[model samples]
Target: MLIPSAQTGLQKALLAIIAAGGVAPAEGADDSYIIEEIRAVGPGCPPGTFDFDAEGQHFVYDEMILWHPDPAGRTVQYTNCLTTIAIDVAEGIQVSVAHARARGHATLDPGIVARHTMKFFFAGDPSGAMSHTELTGPFDDDYDLSGQLSPGGEAWSTCGEPVVLGIDSSLQLNASHNPAGTAELSVDRLDMKIQARRC
Candidate 1:
């Protein structure tokens, strides 16, 4: 992992503990870098409701809920969150989003349906240079889903260039013919494995 320039030994230890079982493995490697910034937007992840930790390697969304009451009487409801992370790394390095996991809870009427979609990509990369996933159901309980980037599916950053990673996720609920029904979805945690290499 890339250590920040201003980080102290204690800070590095704390970050290591927090990032356990999370971030990608590349510790003690060259091309040291730091997460310059993380920007998030959308109704589900408004200001102060979502944040990045572990050196901007992990994301937490507190109150990322999409609720629709009386689906039959109302239009379909959806909520989305878009995040971008800027990484300041030494030149001659490349970065990639290797894996991702999403944990959430959903409550839907028997007839109602919901969809969870996520996409990971590097800024300025071709549209095809991205990882996407979609899962739908009449889910009624907690759920955990994960995705891994295959060898050929990896989206690498441009060698010797700045890296900006974008992650887009959404929860959409569709109404059924039921006269009175409610649908709700809450995304609690989202983890990503961001790896860097010497290119």
Candidate 2:
């Protein structure tokens, strides 16, 4: 059945169906939408900050995005993301992207790309509590993220945190604090150890 769509091409149509992940259609079948049209309605900005004294101190993020014909069969992507030092403020951020895994003779070097899609979770509080934040979609999914942000994803208050995250395999996160919003974060496994100063 070829339903008329305002968009072009057939791949996009099929992509929409398969992209549903596990979200089955409702009882009514008339509900119409687009694949890329599916947007994540969540927090616009990530809240809180990275406390070196508490949650470790430094952290790093990496991932890859590419076309995979088989979702269950293959996840062969060459993606990696990293951000500059950050703290518990609201300063600007800079991120870098590199290739982690690639197939064929092709390779994606750590260069300047654009926005990219991803899933992440963040939790903490410049105050005393904690908070949680999450992003569903509209992923820019770019490459080299010099000025890009890795989905900051969490903004809890005093007792919030990212729980039961349902996103891609990788996530990137960065944060700033204080009036100046300056800090440094490095990663060891999934633990970020921040070494920054807040005044």
Candidate 3:
């Protein structure tokens, strides 16, 4: 999360990014937004394990991991994290999460499978979005999980008011019927694009 001292810097960067998209504001207009609060809960995202980068428009998680360490029997394990962010924006402006990317690593033996699921929505918006990616392997590798949102998938914030955005995610590993397989999956970071435009 960002402190008050960094608010000005974030505002400048955000404004520049928005302007680059051909949505420049009127001269001397200061329609900026700041992250007013962030709350993360779940075993996979404990206190001090998650933070947001205001300038990068991303969230970093240090401890989102799920492991199945036994190679003798079938097992199912899952880890989840839920995060809510409150953003205070200037009047006449609306914001939306235009894109999202997840970076992670996975080590799955033959017959092992893993899946990552995510849900994103605005607090008062009716049309939310859901995305999931699955991986099955016979080896170890790093993976970048990316997906395109459907038309109208972006949930816009209410004009001239603060908005709360929620992100809920989970990682699941299934080693069922695999008598000699082990698996491990870790999600390191979640990157997002916050777009601002006039309402």
Each candidate structure's TM-score, on Cα atoms with residue i matched to residue i, is: 0.75, 0.19, 0.77
- The residue-level lDDT of candidate 3 at 23 comes to 16
| Winner by TM-score between candidate 3 and candidate 2 | 3
Whole-model lDDT per candidate = 0.63, 0.21, 0.68
Candidate 2 RMSD to the correct structure: 20.6
Task: Report model 1's TM-score to 2 decimal places.
Answer: 0.75
Model 3 lDDT on a 0 to 1 scale = 0.68
Give a tens-digit lDDT track for model 2, residues 25-103: 2221111211111111112111221111222222223212233222433322233332111112222321111111111
Clash number by candidate, in order: 2, 38, 0
Q: Residue-wise lDDT of candidate 1 within 1-199, one digit each (tens)?
A: 1111221332333333333432332222234556666667668887789877746667899967877673345647778787766677768777777778888888876676776767555554534222333334455788766664333456577786766666667777776544267678778999887787888
The numbered model that scores best in lDDT is 3
lDDT-based ranking: 3, 1, 2
Q: In terms of lDDT, which candidate is stronger, 1 or 2?
A: 1
Best of the candidates, TM-score: 3
lDDT of 3 at 92: 88
Q: List the residue pairs that clash in candidate 3.
A: none
Q: What is the C-alpha RMSD of each candidate to the true structure, in Å?
A: 10.6, 20.6, 11.1
